[model samples]
Target: MHALSELRQARRFVIKVGSALLVQQGKPRVEWLASLAAEIADLRKASEVIVVSSGAIALGAAKLGLAKGGRGSLADAQAAASVGQVELARLWSDALGHHGITAAQMLVTIGDLEERRRYLNASATLARLLEAGAVPVVNENDSVATEEIRFGDNDRLAARVAQAAGAEAVLLLSDVDGLYDRDPREAGATLIERVEGVTPEVMAMASGASASGLGSGGMLAKLQAARIAERAGIALAIVNGTYVSPIARALDGPVGTLFVPQGDASARKAWLGGRLAPAGVLTVDAGCAVALEKGASLLAAGITEIEGDFARGDLVAIHGPKGERLGQGLVEYTAAECRSIRGLKQDRQADRLGYAPRAAVVHRDHMVRT
Candidate 1:
């Protein structure tokens, strides 16, 4: 349908670019990229921007004359990424530099986002880069990324990055204008403008990978990304990047499928704590319950017993000594670790466990008081 008002009002957001739009016929489209950079420069004055770009492997392989066209072995792909990353970064730097804008390259792997400590650190880095007035151009570390750990496409990565970066919206710019009932060129295919929710029916409309060799994601990946972004209370727009100044146009017009969130950030946090069933239950003493009421974390010393087997990062219900449920939160330590440290002095946790963990069993940020 039309551009969401939230898209235009976003003070911070992500713009994802795929390889097909960045390159054509094994050659970099410098002029198109320069124009896009100009738009980014203009957007930066009033709002913060983070770019998730994909093109290193394609441009890199083409430069080295490696497979004539498609991907080679994992080793060959990583080799291409190692070489192309340099050129890709340089080109982005030069283009943005022309507009007096600074572009910083931050290559990340799946581990960086999946691990709790690394996730916080990576998010802080991106926040700092935006605060310093430099646009962070994020790319997956393809060189060493195995299939098991790989994001597979930049679309899902962009969605995850949007959540971590605290971005209000995510703009996915690809060759397609928006999502359709089917392939647009085919008869009876109709453009679906706004996706209020990503349902089984909505997912059924999605297709496979892109026909273009330069790009990896198709509509399916973008829809999958929209689901992730929606859960994090971020809106995602799937827009066409085939034109110059795509970002601004997408924000100003009916350019793609806009998936709006059903709730705000606080609501999303509430959902995280209670929406999913608790993996396990945790029993804490009275003092810990009081501390939780005062907005403190669940420390090991405060917990008297662990009720079930739950891995780290799993949601757990917190209970008072009398078996009264206090609330739920994400646990930082596994059940086995908690078993060893339960009732132990908080300060002596490292000595007992042989390694230090987070000071709190569950941080306030991940805990919700009910």
Candidate 2:
């Protein structure tokens, strides 16, 4: 399959720009960004695009006259990120602005993506931004991120962002065009055009950490990212960003190594099924169980019991009348609110809950069948 073409055909995709591509000599590459922005403008005509960029710390280090290669104390790097994030956002705004596109900046920590409630919120924000025809430029919350709470590199972060946004593909723009059998510097080294899976052999072929001081990750990190994308049923590609119109070229030619997806659960379902532990349980009546078997959402009228304390957006176990676990889903109401509206018909729910009730206590789309 033509991997890059798949990205072009995707309804939505993410593009990751490494610090090495965005920053040179501690300065943002304005012309390169403009070129990329132009390509993104064309892609946006057919697909929604999100950008995960790295450069804030690098730019900040330069501005603060810190040592090169991001060599500094954690406090210094954080200080640099604080100063550089504004500049990074401005650069993206100006680049995309030239094409009449609006850029929205989003900063996220590991916890933001790991926590169920925060994950839902982040997903909603990304969906809203895309629906509004705005390109969301995401980055690690470097300013506030300690080493323990950080992604350590943008590659994995981009993959997570793609999964969160329900993107079909991710394009990792790096200094190298693609994965090589051996270091490209060595003779006879060949670029692997297509990767079916990130197996142990593939990981072994990868070399040490990033030689480019501006970036933190290397081929290993990218492979880790591809694995994440693979499980989320999202294709990922690693391509050279040094070339002009990289996305356009990748779409039309063999310009990168594409990692195939494993066709597993959707991102939301994956999280609902495995990533999170259920915060509570909702016991539904016999009729409700039958409705669920027919693919109906869990409504308050069907819910007979609520156990444990769970807030809105928390994952909850669904039990049938026989107390058998049916599935788990994200609950739309807090435990207290759910208790107030439990067993109420749609028309009477608002009276007990003191607000217009949602159609489902747990939406079918948000549920994962065991």
Candidate 3:
């Protein structure tokens, strides 16, 4: 268990801003956005900040004169997002600009993180933006993401962003102050300060139901986000967004529930080794086998053969020369594309496919040895 004060010393961090704090009556909360921008600007003086914000669909729905019921079909949400994303980006830019800081919009889909090439590209883009002293405001591409492929909620997206950016922690600023023994709306429900063990009881505290009518997020989503952070070796703090300079205040007071990072190495390895069933198989040459042992990305030139009808981003088994299982990783190319690039040099990828894809068939970061 950790406190928000621990975040003050974190050099790299992600902040998740939910729709509850961002939209009101179908419009952007200008005052709060301004304050949030100021807070982010101040934090940038000492740390690198990445904001994973959730409000496009809500803001879009508001402008479209949708009900506040928070239970719309996927198509309705998508249409709202299509019409509202422009305004959302504009408002964020205007708000941050007031503090002499530039805001960059990054609309990511679930596939963006699942695919090895896109994952690397996104990470590189974020790093470049941060290095140039700009805050990246990340949001899901709700306009095009279908129900099954969606990240589901921004809470999960925030955790993924933290992992991709290699952030030390994620501060989830929501409507409520923190996690409670029961529903906060219930009488005599006390807030839990520091969460160390994500036991069954702790998980049971967060309901699967939505928290507020304005947003799709709930305590369960935050808990899921915490689990992702724990596996990624990063802390997650969930706090209320009612106060002025909430980020600064969160770092100084007992205002939120903090989940400490735990079981990162073992959990990640276990997930890769046991939980995932290989969707495809890649048999590598002897030299490639040796290189993989030394921790190298799986390149097309090294793959002797490909098996299975797997698509890009699907987990694939890596086999050594003697047919021994070496490891498993997400494939960067579909099975069809893999066959075309077999034994081809990295630079020749574009020539073979008529368009350049990633060089590695499987990136090292997504690999796990069993």
Best by lDDT: 2
Candidate 3 per-residue C-alpha lDDT over 1-370 given as tens digits, one digit per residue, 9 for 90 to 100: 3677878888898998888788877767888888988988888889999998888888778778766422377777888887778888898899888988889999999878765567768888999999998889999998898876777788878888887787888999988898999988899999998898566679889987766666677888888788767766788999888676888777777689999987565433423432224778999999999999998999999999899999988889999988887888888989999999998898888887889769589998878764
lDDT of the candidates, in the order given: 0.82, 0.87, 0.82
lDDT of 1 by residue, 167-286 (tens): 988899888888898877799998898988888689889887685766668889898788777767788998888898887677677567899775554633624532324678889999
What residue runs in model 2 are displaced by over 4 Å at the alpha carbon?
266-269, 272-370
- Model 2, range 22-114, lDDT digits (tens) per residue? 888998888899999999999898999999999999998889888854457888888889989999999999999999999999999877786
TM-score of 3: 0.74
Cα distance off (Å), candidate 3, residue 284? 28
Clashing pairs in 3: 26-62
Return the TM-score for each candidate structure: 0.74, 0.73, 0.74
CA error at residue 68 for candidate 2, angstroms: 2.9
Span of 10 residues, lowest total lDDT, candidate 2:
268-277
Query: Hey, what RMSD does candidate 3 come out at?
Result: 8.9
lDDT of 1 at 179: 89
**For candidate 3, what is the total of clashing residue pairs?**
1
